[model samples]
Target: MPALNAEKAIAQEKAIIINTESLNVRNGPGLSFSVAKQVHKGDEFQVVSSENDWYEIKLNSSKTGWVANWLVTLKAGSSAKKGTVTEDGLRVRDGAGTNYSVVAALNNGEEVSITEEQGNWYKISAGSIAGWVHKDYIAGDAPETEDSETVSNVQPDNWTGISTDNSLNVRNSPGLHGSIIGKLNKGDKVSVTGSVSGWFRIEFGGIEGWVSSQYIEKPSSASKPPANQVSYGKVIINSLNIRENANLNGKVVGSVKQGEVYEILEEKNNWYKLSLKGGKTGWAAGWYMEKTVAEKPQKQQSTRKAEEVQILYNGTNLRSSAFTNSAIVARASSGETFPIKKKTGEWYEVSLKNGQTGFVASWIVSVSGSSDSAPVNKPKSGGLKGKTILIDPGHGGRDSGTIGYRGTFEKDLTLSTSQILYDLLKKAGADVILTRNDDSYSSLNTRVALAHYHDSDAFISIHYDSISDSSVKGYTAYYYHQYQKELSQTVLGSLVKSLSSRNRGLKQGDYFVIRENKQPAVLLELGYLSNPSEEALTRTHSFQDMAARSIYNGLDEYFSE
Candidate 1:
């Protein structure tokens, strides 16, 4: 929470790169240093000294690399600039000049700096920047007053020695390349227990780990609070490169969203094995998710006019009527602004600047004078015009019901196929309900609840079959409740006829989604995941369309009866 001013002199400082590009090193102003290795944009570095356009920096520990001055900026605020506590907090600006952009504002007395001055703005080279703060807002810049007490007692002995410049590696084991976990940034404090071949055995984020001594600085007696401890109670989505194993080149499963909550069940090295609230468990790197709430600007005047609403997506058209078939009068691009004149159902009558009036789906456009926005159409389809079917893709996140042979996750395949099917149904004038759109992990309860909540006429779960035998192939329909038997049979027959693979036939299953679903529900295993040939074919456009057409035919047949 300390203000990071670029100019505030501190015994130590760390620069965490936010830009997702590398900082290329070039020999120039300070030619006295030998440089090696490219500094990836997000990599953190320790500031040893700065003169002119070149900075003498240490990256990932042992190596002394000269970083280009502009690519990597520093933060400046510390306790000394304002007697350890000033009445006003510092601001973070984009650049060291007055005209720089304001990246973030700070609370009063927060630790940050007033490193230098360019015109009216004082540069606080900290985590971020603040631009053009009034002189009155500036606080104490005088050196440490006599009243400044030595809080070194709060500092752990030799803990501060672990700087970001060390070859510090968070690993699954104590030795080299043992699943390199998290990268240690400059000024990161960790309690050292032992050392091996320039590797420091340190306790990191409540887990015992090893960091290369080359990347860490010598321990300082100065005490600062250990970087905020990870709170285990709240859930966090993994935001960094999360792999199956804790290795650098490990295959990425997927990234966890920032600010997502997860329950921490265990910790090893720098990996926090977490249990998601949705009953899914996964390992995540400790360095990625920061646990801090930033205060956002709440009082800025409305930059947009009350009559203008921005378009959410491109190809948005103004139709004659609220219906999708009302006939397009005009098309709007993404971010186009328009004024709403009236509302009919979920559609809005928007009057364009050229005096043309037509209806737009309100969900796709935001109200100009208000902060509210809505989706153009709610996923819930009310009209059962052609065929009424709810396609629920099961087990989002960790509950991926089954895994395919070629490493195609069930969650992904189901959602992909469901989307194609939904589009097909829509184009055919069939009413459809897709439980979810994106790769969000959802629970079976939620999936079933959605179908019943929408009063869907029928519910079908989409999935790819997986088995130990790579030869097992073809589509299969599963029905639990007897009411869904007729629908399942019809869909199954069409799938077997439409798809070229072996027919698995319709069978009864106690699948949780179908058994508990309030509406008539059936689960479909469209293809075998273990069969490589089938897997490849299942992923094709032709196969997806065939599956959709088959399902539609089956629905039509069932409904006709």
Candidate 2:
């Protein structure tokens, strides 16, 4: 059945803008040559190309630009087809709306510019940031044009890969629970062919295997790995004083000392087994220093610049080939280092310092963002500042605490609200502590461990209220021991005072994070997830600010007392 809606019916007769203000350019679809100027909201234009969500269009007297598919309503007697923009931005392809190109986002309440006319598409300018939109999403207008272009003429040379935090399963076969040959990290590039049940078969390191296409970038034929070539890579240690051994183990094989150079040979597991000066071989774990984890160190046999790359996370699988379809060579974790042998589009063929070679996902590991990326390493803070408090976001990754209404995951909201609190506290000048930084799940013990590690003056865990009802509201605060009564009271009082919701008040509750911590600890349930309105509001920045400010002010009052 045809996808239909209110917007479609209205667009059939209108000429308007979508994703207003997009600058069309010559690079990609939305980035083609800039033609016309900005089309204000509710303005009309003539469309030239009508592909997917993008309408290659020109204003009646204006040049041409692309507009998003969502921003327009139809004008009576307009010759544009009918369509509606979904909640999320839709894709806009080139040619005859066949093979889809990358997606162009069209936010709510935005207008699309129209250029040319097609059966259901109006080519228009989406603005300088994002380009065009299809006419199908335009409400109240319609126009008809020829299906003139083919996909072959406008396809891109390279396919972009997105980052996936989780370690992806690489299988020898293409089915569920297929033999787990190895695993791939986020950003690893692959050459795609036939897909089996949503699974994509990719070519990596000369081997072919299947991986879920959902996590990484889509495979395209235009992007292919280069032929085998040697490349050189250097080892980078986070701690400047990494110790070297005579052998693979820390057997004091005579310390090469930090910053000493060694010849590359082989990479295994997370260790770079190196060839020392006297023909002796010694091994160092990749974690000891930031070194590349895939492929053999590129010997100078081939000339290639040393590429600075970081491991995305711990335990990324290294493949013998550039595609996930290749054979498994080794495994690497975050902070490991390596050199690039060659790059095929987005995937880089990398060699470990110790000489092992393989393919690793590029997006999972940041090529530029380093742990030391922040300038002037601030001394890890001591206790939450008396003025600003840091709220540690808890249970990211696999450590989701409890499930709430409509499957509102706890980890998502905890981190979400904590981030809000962190920003508010920091802006307000209170020193804060974040137990864990990213979504990688941390243990409960780690929560208190961070507080003790930083000697935080006070500790607080932010959570959402969850009861059987799908429509309950209010906020609550919990403390495990009596010693934390003052801290809890201050936070609770401020929260109750600031928020426009029911006050569940302070209660005695034993939580592992509070029970095990040395400093004053409090856990807050700021609102009920079961209530639809409250749940939605809790997800927004405004409500979070209210909570953060309330907590901050509460801390101020408590410390003063």
Candidate 3:
């Protein structure tokens, strides 16, 4: 099983070749899976890619299967020593140094058969996927396989662990912001089904939930928090109070907003003691902070010059391949800059600081704003500070809104979009209140009432439009009062620029939230769920993130003005 300290990965996947006789190729990705075929150590196959410690080789035009990269080796080259990959997301450069281009990436515990060595680079190869990895990150060797029977039986067992701390929270999802669903007491036995981002999924009391791997004890994963080892935590909520104590009534020492980070000094009773400036410390609620879990040594900012092109907003998708439908390599955060390597019709190939390349949409890069291509790092808290933004997800419960061309519920989409918007706004330093954070329903009156009661600076009613004509696909903003016209136009302007959607234009419409509310308000029909293509696009994580970011950017502009 993978360790908790490792960076966010499904699992590690790197290896080198061997010259052993008659090696078994697995039908599946792991050793425990059935063998598909046998090949000599030097037998070559068309190498496509690697994932989760397995090499994908094309058997024929239509057929493909996984093989252990450990069993395959280069026919001519002989290895000096077998090594282990020490870091997650370690660059496999074309040469040994940072100047070299990244040919591939290695994850923690991956096999590293060093064929040759020069300075800091080692010639590591497993068939077609061959490159030089840094020597400092190559550990001694992967565990030697003594026998076939023993190797075939190697698989991770489901974790049976005892809770080491009192009241270990089990969340609905992996991260700290995932709502708390239950708790486990000290010494209680629990079984782990999975792990992601340093959190373990376990089944308890008829609920499958996740808990921090830190407070749980499994013989293999059992370890205590290191002394003087600090973790960087990004604020997950808008404007969290940094207090003098761990309790609610503690004196407010300082304030931090979304996109802000601090070094954690200690953790107690669901609160984090933060290392503030001038060597002082302050306590903040842990539930509003997301801890970084990077096992690799942190890469420093590039001393090289900046690129001309930069992402205008956060949640921008970075594709791994040239093809438009390729796998998402990563998500670029706002204000995080990258030098443009080149540009095609629709995509911008950007060189990341990690020495790897990724493609982003040109439309996103071209959307110049007040902070367009800002600095490469995430920006400090901005216009969202002290702003009370009410987000009303349009429909819920029995009110499913319009049915999409793909049968997607409009209520579900609204809720999903609003939830993401809430996070972004909170992180940006807004006191964001969601009318319905879950599947529950809220009457229009209640939603409007909530905004008025909070004395909200701005109110946004999020919905998706539908039409009988499937050809019609676009986003629109509506305002019921003259006061909301500017808000509607500003937000819709941002949506049109940042997203690849048609602008249906802002219209004066009698929407209850906008008409009845005294605050500056707008109702956004983000997209036409009835359009098959647009419906499919709206459901993606990338699109949802982009939509939320666009709206947040619009609000930021409104508040700044």
Candidate 4:
């Protein structure tokens, strides 16, 4: 075969890295390629080419490599002034010119706080090290000292955190050399007092200390509502349960009566903290409550047109941006109306009752007095008739996934079952697409890209479970967010009812496919391949057919509702 020319297929565009963690720059456009360098969050690069979901990036005048497109944001304009280093071991000097003594060696993608500038040299700080770097290496906005915003020292209230790692050391200070005063085990609750840099100060077991914020499960700044933004939430569900914390596993504090309105304090991960009637506060699931419009003073009707739209789907997400991957700012229920500010492609920018702006999908809502609005009465067609579903088979190619006791390859089983599902859904008049048709290698990013490109209504990732304990045997469905919980429950319920297996019920999993997927996505763990009995049954075609039929029935029920 002739040598393949990779350079001929790239698009010239400017992009900025968005991944919070460091991303590797590879020699080629796939995972099989070797890592040439690394790029940190806030770094910018010129896109020299593109292949599938990967972009060939121009790191510098002498370096070029490929990076995953999902990790970067593509934009058209002048790049930001602040940025990160693109290559490892870049020298951080005491002065801007090359003659300056080296103060520190910065790693690839390391973030720097820029302060002053002198010609080609910029004064910056990486962690505790203050130094200057050459202008050619930086990637974001380089703002002058006077233009930069000062950091606020305001602390949050009633914040609780859970330790994610075992024997997490509690220190007296925020840095690594801080004195270790105590330790906390995994899942241990700590009352967070404040934060400094990337460290969180906590009071655990009466001992006040600091811990790396990365290992604690606390509400991020992005999840919190804007300051001084107050809104009222009307409880819609009968006896809505309120928890002491944001998660589902948090202790139940009390219950709110249906139709009772409460002042909303904040929002985190689709949960709202409400101030109850008795001076008590607790978190309530956002899906069960609707934002009630506060009674405004009566006034004469004005001639201004009411630019409003009503939600058509229950549990619809109101995102911070027009993209599905953006953080969900709030959740809305069916029949709730919001005034529109503008439109961006398939999303409508709307003003919420809380005085905040968010974007909602255009298809799931109907605009008042507009020709683009969907009919008030939904069509009677089968839910899956014209829906696009993306079926993803877990592992393939060089990856064998989990091996069963009966020598069954997980990749093979997943592909076989997905193929059957593809056929069945296709026969039902649904536009179904498979992530992989054969035993071919596909990256997780590729799978997600396929779902977005096809505008899929639902994404199902199929896989078999394996563990050291052979006695465990059950079917579990997993979802990442509250909005996806219904889909998971419906599918898992049908599978358990149709097949002879233990129903493990719905689980909140953090798997990549389900977590990163923009559409209603679920990962189904059919049965435990480690169990001898389950492995034998999973190898049979009857079980696969039954599972496919159950999923089909589940989709029908989910969409019909």
Candidate 5:
């Protein structure tokens, strides 16, 4: 009866293979034993006995060897479980148990397709390594083999999506039990073809597979404009803020500089919806944008005698109206000459070589033998007259500072505003000195030193603020000392009144220029570049003019006090 029992046990023993590239077969169940032979991946052997983490196997008719349990898998199963390695460097052995020889290793989080199960072991194949792992270290569900004949015949759609999970399995069928064929990382885009149950049929890296619908997201419908529409608008502000919504408190997404042109989509309330380059869309205040007229084909020269005009600026917009806020038809570079049809107020109507007719700013063009138009200069205000003021425009050169969504640079805005303020202050008769007059770099210490050298009555540093949260918008004034706080408050209050933007209020800050300067110093965050609305507003000439006037008025008030 005992011999019969032993025969039955032997009959139940199954054939297995070296699942790794090379596996060592040893004479005993422990690492201390001598190696009997090396077997390559897919080499088959019969299981004879198991002890600890080692498997005693039959190599041939006359030999038996011990292999690490994790390195071998049962050769009979057509399906297995899907799992992932829980820990890094988990060893793959040549048998079902650890006492068997080591065959390979698995990195943490590595995915595997299980093929069979035995006792406390699961057979798996991860990439180039096929082996057995202890059930305690794997996390997965039972695997289901796919029958190609049973695949759904649903045709794919044109929708696209992105994977939301850090590690998502792509299976051959649309279910958790299906065989995993690939993997996707978080944010990976896929072409969704069909859907079944809660799974999406997708094409990833040229492989068609199924992923859970819960982990996919469709692209935003508003990210791009509809095809074939071609309406255009011009940015009227030096830096016009673009917002996600058409409201005063909407989040800022980007900014567009004065002279930039964009395609207009729709207008609502006081905002113009613009289709920006690179598949982006945003809304800007309609009050700051003007519709651009379509370019007309250049007309052939005829007997209607025309006057010659030369472009005076490097890049001057040729518009289709007599108004400064009109739509731009083309750009005329400095030294470019054109035939003038006539002049209206401050704009000159010109006929281009391309047969197009447009308007150029009268100030940016010179008519042959005509006297230059008088510049419209602002009148001087008396209160700030004779006060020595120091202006510091923050950031320059390689330090671009914050860049808004529409590519408006904080450094550029600062310089533009500072120059405007300098003009306004100088016109008011204040002795003013600028830390930087161009796109150049100056260290914080250098700015403070210049202020001291000038012995200025007040030092004001201009800057734009940026934050990770794009929703934040407003203007803030900062002072490092108690004596400067009142100045900060006065200036900030005037700014809020002038620009009509949110008042971020005054705060004591320890900026180097403000803290280190001996003279009364203040730093102003004109607006948030991260906020689309504020960014656009801050970049406008009207905003800059308002800001400059506010600062001048604040200085006037401070001196009067």
Candidate 6:
């Protein structure tokens, strides 16, 4: 049994309309704090959260600020949601607490309409009865219209399948109008409980849920990878969209660039669901991706002084000796990682998974560990090597940026991502300088001063965007000076190649740091933190690595030009 606790609960969906002719949004809840942004009368903003007599609202897609509650009118309550009872004998009360009278009792598998939510309780109505119940007993997700047409129920032969979407919604019923109770990530295995029309009812989040049949793939010996082995896919096209659904009508979620490799999660009609980085997954046209049958070598126990290496390109031939003329032992697939026993001239003597030794071209494969830990190919000393690069992690200390849907702080995300980018540039032999290494706050003027003081070759500011509209997503590049335009494009272009999110392209911005700096600079709005899905993706380590690698590659390309 769960109890109601207002302090720890997530903010409900709500908005506030500015009433005063002009209202100044402050940095904090009090009037003593500095103004963060300004909003005119009649302007409405989504309320992120509320404090004592103050409400936090979205100023833009990338930042948030606080406004006095007295100057704005709170909008109507949150929209209704459909729910299904997960437990039997759930008590429905007249109010939101145990002290209230019991109105009714709900059984498992019963459906209800959630009209309002208060703390840990939900005001639900089922048929004629209506009352409050503990939210823990009900599985509620997305909103849905009133169900009218009877869903056609059927029985299917297959009972097990893999989800083919990055985040496949699991509905309470069998149709698009059904209430969403959970989600399935790319390659998640599901056990079918029932079937209806074009949907399959499966056990999701320990509750009965339905998912589209089109994105579910049945397992088999021929199509499935070997036991304890994974599959990889190589993007053959210049660019490929990772859509929300497998069909062309689906919305674009992310993208993959040519020559990039990702692990295959599931396969559908002419489509392949790929595991990009971290927990992000999406479907790409299988025709544009070459399916590579390869897996990481099974864990080895023997004490061998060797570092792991992966083939960068598919169908690379493993030679008998260090020379190309040597007899071809085997062909390696893309994304397959192996251990290198020794390094020969222009070749790596690798130990294959099948207990065989062969030599592969060094240029075609990438070493796994850092420079000192592995035989990494060092930079040519002409690109980013020894270049003074300054990284500014936007917002810190009391000045947190945007607030995520899940209550994630924008300051924390920027700091962590900056650390990753800093390490990558440092490893590449660049003289990387960070505006603030920790949670301490630095004024915008101070940040810009670092660039001029160091004669920085490039200054890059990192931030995650947010806005009132959750639907708006993707990465954005901002630059003020004309010279910064090229730098913005170069960095953003490389970033789009590696990111799974949308390509928002570059735009002119007038921010204090980039506008005052004389050196080449660009501020990157990485992803929409306000969007629940994009926020989760940006917080992953793989996402951070991809961002850093792309920026480094972009700087390298810009210098080479």
Which window of ten consecutive residues has the lowest lDDT sum in model 1? 291-300
lDDT of each: 0.57, 0.53, 0.66, 0.70, 0.69, 0.72
Instruction: For residues 412-499, write the lDDT of model 6, one tens digit per residue.
Output: 6788788888988898888999998766667565686567556678899998887667788999898888877888999999998899
Off by over 4 Å in 5: 1-382
Q: For residues 330-371, could you state the per-residue lDDT of candidate 4 as single tens digits?
A: 999855789899989888999999999999977565566454
| lDDT ranking of the models | 6, 4, 5, 3, 1, 2
Model 2 clash count equals 122
Please give the range of 10 consecutive residues that has the lowest summed lDDT in model 6.
372-381
Q: Which candidate tops lDDT?
A: 6
Worst 10 residues of 2 by lDDT: 142-151
Q: Which stretches of candidate 3 lie over 4 Å from their true place?
A: 1-382
Find the number of clashing residue pairs for candidate 3.
Answer: 7
Name the regions of candidate 6 deviating beyond 4 angstroms: 1-381
Query: Global CA lDDT of candidate 1, please?
Result: 0.57
Clashes of each: 60, 122, 7, 12, 30, 3
TM-score to native of every candidate shown:
0.36, 0.35, 0.34, 0.36, 0.34, 0.36
- Residue pairs that clash (backbone atoms under 3 angstroms), model 3: 13-53, 17-72, 17-73, 18-72, 238-426, 258-427, 337-376
lDDT of 1 by residue, 157-225 (tens): 333344554224565444332345466543444666665544566766556666556676664457534
Candidate 4 global lDDT: 0.70
RMSD of each: 22.2, 21.2, 24.0, 18.5, 27.9, 19.1
